[model samples]
Target: MRREVPLAITFITGFLLIIGFFIPHDPIGGLQSMFLQWYAIIAGFTMVLGLMTLTRIHTRRIVKRTQGFGYSVILIGAMLGTLVVGFYSGIKYKGLFELGTPFMWYYNNILVPLSATMFSLLAFFIASAAYRAFRARTIEATLLLIAGVLVMIGRVPVGNLIWNKLPIIAEWIMNIPQLAAKRGILIGVALGMIATSLRIILGIERTYLK
Candidate 1:
């Protein structure tokens, strides 16, 4: 009974949202707006569920005194602190986000740098992987190796001294092949998404868990 009601609501709301994009009538538009409002409410409730889960898991870890327990405490403390400060300063006081608030400052300074540092650290790992995989033992590997080396050197002045072809090769590698492959993969993904949507609409897939 608990699951059945939610499932019914899910199906009804989802059907409305999909049909809303096509229908032009005022009644259907109103129905779409109502369903969208319901979806927003559901999303708010789900956010609370996430908060509860975070609190539950962190509280357990702190109580058990497990390894890296301090970091977990820091994670929860930072999250709650930011939430409270942002809520009061922005929503309650300004009725909008305060750009100069400490919460915003910490997000811009600490969070952004930390994320970038993590991503930048990948450069070394990528270099190592590329070193192993781009060996010129085979014809395709040799071609790929040449392309990579050219692109790497092209941005530097020494590449011109080595050969004038490096910059042109790099341009083709970056602009032509990269864009073509990316667009092809994106198109395939879009088609797959459409197929998945159709499957869900016809009840062939039951992945939309309540």
Candidate 2:
């Protein structure tokens, strides 16, 4: 009965939303707005649920004294501290959580530097991976290697000294090949989304319910 009720609600809601897109009338539009509000409320609850889940998992790890348990403790402490400070301080003035607040101080000093260091480490790892990948084994690999080298050089002032046409070639590769490939992937993704949405509406996609 529980499963059936949710499935029925999903089917009805999906069908109504599909219909509402075509018929932009009074009752359907009103229903869509109300549904969106309800969705926002549900989303808020989901965030709370996610935080609870995170706390539970970390607390269990701490209790078990598992490997990297100290990291878990630190994560839980940081999360709870951030939440308390954010709520207590109150974010006023549009994305700036109250000047001279504990939240703002923690965010600016601690969070920003930590995030920057993480990204810097990520760049180092990415460069190492790219070096491994760009070996001139095959024609395709050679072409990729050349393109990557040119792009890297072209972005700096030294490339102009090396060759006048390097920047132009780099720009052409990015604009033509890269942009075309990106568009092709986007089109495929859009088609897949449409297919998935249709399947969901038709009740052929039941994994979501599960």
Candidate 3:
């Protein structure tokens, strides 16, 4: 019954949404909004459940004195601190989680800086990957390497100083080849999604039941 009920709901909801897209009648449209609202409420509860799960896992790690448990301690402490401040400010004090509040202050000063540092590290790793991948071993690889270099240079002011036409060439490459590649990828993704949706609607994709 547990498996059957979820599958039944998936099939019905999938078809209703599909049919609603084509029909656009009042009842179907209203049902879509109602379902979306229900989804939002469910999502909120899921977030709380997720937070509890995180806390449980980290607490277990801390209790067991696992390797790098210090990081888990920091993570749990930060999460609990944020949650407490957010609830206290918003619920008890009738203040908001807005810019001037402690919640936003921690979010902006601590979280944003940490996130920016992570992204900066990511950019360094991306550059390393590009260097390895763009080795001019083949004709295609050479062309790709040249295009990447041109784009990188064109984004900065020195490329214009080096050669005025470099920016124009870079823009052409992006607008023509890059745009075409993106559209092709998008079309493939759309077709794949349609096939997967059909599988779910027909109960062939029952992995979700687990």
Question: How many clashes in each structure?
Answer: 0, 0, 0
lDDT of 2 by residue, 1-210 (tens): 867877788888888887888887879977877788898999999999999999999999999999999999999999989988788777543444777878899899999999999899998899999989999999999988998998999878899889988888889989999899999999999999999988877778889775
**Candidate 1: deviation at residue 18, Å?**
3.1
Write down the TM-score for model 2: 0.88
TM-score of each: 0.78, 0.88, 0.92
The regions of model 3 sitting more than 4 angstroms off are 92-97
Question: Model 1: how far is 164 from its true place, Å?
Answer: 5.2
Scored by lDDT, model 1 comes in at 0.82
For model 3, how does the per-residue alpha-carbon lDDT over 120-199 read when each residue is reduced to its tens digit? 99988999999799999999999999999999998789999999998998899899999999999999999999999899
Lowest-sum lDDT 10-residue window in model 2: 88-97
| Cα distance off (Å), candidate 3, residue 202 | 1.6
**Which pairs in model 1 have colliding backbones?**
none
lDDT over C-alpha atoms for residue 161 of model 1: 81
Q: How many backbone clashes does candidate 2 have?
A: 0
